[model samples]
Target: MSQTGYQSFEELIVWKKARELKNELFQLGKAFPPEEKYRLTDQLIRSSRSINAQIAEGHGKRTNKDKIKYCTQARGSISETINHLIDAFDCGYISTEQLKRYRIRFDELEKILSGYIKYLRSLPGD
Candidate 1:
C-alpha cells in the first residue's frame, strides 16, 4: 500500500506480518505438551503478540523519539521470540522442521521492522 493509504497500524506490512506470525505461532503452540500451557506456551504467545503491539503503540507515541524507542522494543521482542523458539527446540517441544520454518518467519519480521526503523530514522525533524 502507498504511504498515503496507510491510515492505521492495520495498513502496515510489518504489523500485518507480525499478526500472521502470531497466529501461526498460536497454532503451532497447540502441539506443545499440555504441561507447558502456562509456561513456554504463554511466553511464546506474549512475545509473538508483543511484536505487533509494539508497532501499534509506537505509531501512537507523542514523539518520533518515543515511537522509535517502541519500535526498537518491538525489534527486541522478535529476537526474544526467536530465543524462545530455540528453547522450545532444545526441549523437544517442536520438531526441527517447525523450528526452521518459524525461524524464517521471525527473520522476515525482523527485516521488515529494520526497514521500517530505517525509514523512520530518515524522516526529517527527528
Candidate 2:
C-alpha cells in the first residue's frame, strides 16, 4: 500500500493503539481463573478486538456516513472494553494500578476515535 496518506486502516494511530489495547486485554484476561475463560474473559477479548476490526471496516467504506457509523461501533466497543476491565478490577482479577493503566490507554483511544469521527462528519457532501 502507498504511504501517500494513510493508505490503509493499519496506518491509523488509533487502530495501532486499539491493537495494543487488545493485546493488553488478552494479557489481563489470561490472569483470570479458568471459570471466567468463557465468560468475562471472552467478552473482554471480543470487545477489545472489535475496536480495531470495526475501525478497519469503517475505513473500507465508501461514504463518510458509513465510516461514521462503523467508527461509532468502534467507540462503543472501546466503552465495552472499559466496562469489562472495570468488572475485572471489581472482581479482584486485576490490580487497581493495572486498571488505571488500561483506563488511560483506552481513554486516549476514545479521544482519538472521537476526533476521527468528527473529522469524517465534517467532510464535504457528508
Candidate 3:
C-alpha cells in the first residue's frame, strides 16, 4: 500500500485527473497537422503522458523522499505540458478557447498533485 492509503496509483484522485488530462491531450494531438507529427504533437503527447507515469512510479517507491521526488517530477511534467499547449496555440493548431480550457484543467491537476505531495510529506517516514 502507498503512504497515502491507496493500493495503486490508479486509485488516487490526482492520478485519475492526470490520466483524464493525458487522454484529452492525446485526442487533441490527433488533430494536429501532419507536418507536426515528429515535433509539437510528439512532445505534447509525451509530456502529458509523463504526468501520470511519474505519479504511478512515485507511488510505487519504497521511501517518502523518493515518492516526493517523483511527484515533483510529475509537477514539472505538468508545466512542460502547458508549455507545449501554448506552443500549439501559437502555431494556430489550437484556438484561444482551447488553450484556456486546457490551462484550467492543468491548473486543477497541479493543485491536486500538490496536495498529494503534501499528504505524502505528512506521513511518518523517510
Instruction: Report every candidate's CA lDDT.
Output: 0.90, 0.92, 0.95
Candidate 3 Cα errors over 4 Å, as ranges: 1-6
- lDDT (10s digit) by residue, model 2, range 48-69: 9999999999999999999999
lDDT of 3 by residue, 1-126 (tens): 679765888888999999998999999999999999999999999999999999999999999999999999999999999999999999999999999999999999999999999999999987
Top-down TM-score ranking: 3, 2, 1
Ranked by lDDT from best down, the candidates are 3, 2, 1
* All models, RMSD in angstroms: 1.9, 1.5, 2.3
Question: 68-93 in candidate 1: lDDT tens per residue?
Answer: 89999999999999998998999998
Which run of 10 residues does model 3 get worst, by summed lDDT? 1-10
Model 2 RMSD in angstroms: 1.5
Q: Which lDDT value does model 1 have at 25?
A: 87
Best by lDDT: 3
Task: Give per-candidate clash totals.
Answer: 0, 0, 0
Worst ten in a row by lDDT for model 2: 1-10
